[model samples]
Target: MRINQFISHNTSHSRREADELIKQGLVKINAKIAQFSDRVKQEDRVFIKDKRIHKKTQFSVIVYHKQKGELVSHKDDRGRKTIYENLPKKFSSWLSIGRLDFASEGLILLTDSALIASALMKSDLEREYYLKIKGHINKEVVEAMENGLEIKNEKKGAHSKSKISSMMIAPFLEYEIFGSSGGYTKLRVVINEGQNRELRRFFGHFDLKIMDLKRVAFGIVELDMLRAGKYRYLEKTEYEKLRDFLRINAIKF
Candidate 1:
């Protein structure tokens, strides 16, 4: 693996931070300054700030049933409740895989292994969401969405003009409509890529308002019976299944 990946896997730093440390001349390999392109071998002696780094023998992964209104970050400037607040104090070192906006809720994965987290993030794994929206949706809109739609960028300032920034093709890999009720419609959407506010932005193109959005699953790991505001360590079988789904072999330190 690359030096940055190795560093991130063995230390508390992120890949970017590892790169920064290397660039700043803080990392050494075999008594030589490490380079960004360097690859680590089992025999190479790697050190950071004169201290040797060792791979973790064990790691932990957890699934949290995040509740709406909770921030995914460790701390919020507005003093709102965050996912870390709901987790046990021992999980302070764990890193969240992805984020759910304050208005969104559901399954969020946390892990102590940056290797696993990084691999999972880089993989094109599918995520499923259940959403409730206002207004009626027809086959034409669905088809258009499935094919792709050009979402225009909103004005940045009061004096700015809106323009077509980019196109958002069928955000959903698969979708099923559960019909409508009380002027609202329920739908399940599966997407391979996790773009920022993608679902909301896609529906906004049609002037449809999203009333509720909750992630139900990530790849092979489903929310299942996990209650909101609660979390649990991933079962060994579940973790193995996730690793296999991501096509990642055993994580070596």
Candidate 2:
């Protein structure tokens, strides 16, 4: 195993943070400052900034109905408000799995298990979003989006190649399938990639404005009977489904 993985499995810090510590030379393996790629055996001694590692709490999961205008991160440099401010005090040490932009609202999953969050954030895991867009949508556009829409002028992260674009099509994308008399239409978008503002940008490519957007489903978890701005614990069956799916797909830390 890698030194960062050992720190993550035994310390309170999340895996992402563990990698940062290793990169910053704050972590030591057998009295030597650790590098991210350093290997460790079961008998190796570990320390984080001179403190010995200890076992962290078991993984816990929660489903939160994020309100609009709340940033998904813990701290906003611009002083914009965040969803963490509204979270219960007892729910510390949990990391958000993926994210919903400040203008979008819907089901956001939080977990103490770094592995689960990382697994769910993988591009292979399917996520469903409910979108309400302005103006009437055309069947050709819907079909195009369902096939794959190329979005220009978007930031591509380090993990992605340059000129990255999201490529998830609506399963039932017929134009006659959706309608709203008030000039707004609703549709469900199922995608595997969770790039920043991807779904909204997809519609924007067709000159469609997203008035409201929310994620209603991820993996086996759905927003059934759940009200807005509330939270609930996931059931055992849902957890099992997520675990089985991750295992079958070879997603592991």
Candidate 3:
């Protein structure tokens, strides 16, 4: 494999991230600093920073509290704001595991290893989101969403359904869902799917307006007391827990 490809597959660093590592003189091959275009043979020793490459410690994960209007990608063609700009200078060579639309704000996971990112992004990984919608959400609508609905494109001959797992519903605190144009309304929703704009699409189907959406939890990683726009290093235990989760859940074909 090529050096860049090797880094991408073994760690959460994207192709671009691997290139940056090469430029920064952090990646080594066969006891020598490796270039981005260098080819990696099976026996070539790879080192990231000062540590020898090891599958157990190869990836680092972080949960970022994204703000509205920030693009999830590292760079945007339209010069729009990006989450990368908000990260500290040392938070380098990481890529988002999944995306949060510019209009949404919530927990976003980023990683330095591509393999770990791929594992967590798989469909079986259960993610949790909390949404505040305008007005009362009819119980029937909730059931419809839980049961899965035919999305817009699937409205034709063969309808398709996007299912939510482990849904929990209750009334949200009146003040919790503030900042909407409409009057205070009681709404509480929890969903397991992290599909793009999924909560908004579900509300749109019922003609209900969504005021705010936040992803509160991802697997075992929860927002906890981490303030918005702040991030911390993922401890070794956290990474091991995630790896164990994947090990137990990975599907075999």
lDDT digits (tens) for residues 157-246 of candidate 1: 111232434555554688899999999999998888775677776776677778899999997788999999999888889877875765
lDDT of 2: 0.74
TM-score of 3: 0.68
Q: How accurate is candidate 1 locally (lDDT)?
A: 0.81
Worst 10 residues of 1 by lDDT: 155-164
Which scores higher on lDDT, 2 or 3?
2
For this target, which candidate reaches the highest lDDT against the unseen true structure? Answer: 1
lDDT against the true structure, each candidate: 0.81, 0.74, 0.67
Q: State residue 127's C-alpha deviation in candidate 2, in Å.
A: 1.5
Q: Candidate 1 at 184: error in angstroms?
A: 1.2
Q: Residue pairs in steric clash, candidate 3?
A: 11-113, 11-114, 12-112, 12-113, 12-114, 13-112
Which numbered prediction scores highest in TM-score against the true structure? 1
- Predicted candidate 3 versus true structure: per-residue lDDT over 1-253, tens digit per residue: 6888777767656687789999999999968999767997767788999777644345567889988888887688889988889997656567677887777777888877666666677644556666666666566675665566655432121113434332222222112332333453544455555555565665666777666767767777877777878887677788778768767776210
Candidates 1 and 2, the one with greater lDDT: 1
> Looking at model 3, which ten-residue stretch has the lowest summed lDDT?
166-175
Which tens-of-lDDT digit does each residue in 1-253 have in candidate 2? 6776666656667668899888788888879998878887757778888987754545678999888999889888889988778888766567899988888888899987666677778745677777788877787676776577665555432124335554443343322335676889887767777766676666667777888888888778887778877889989998777667877878663
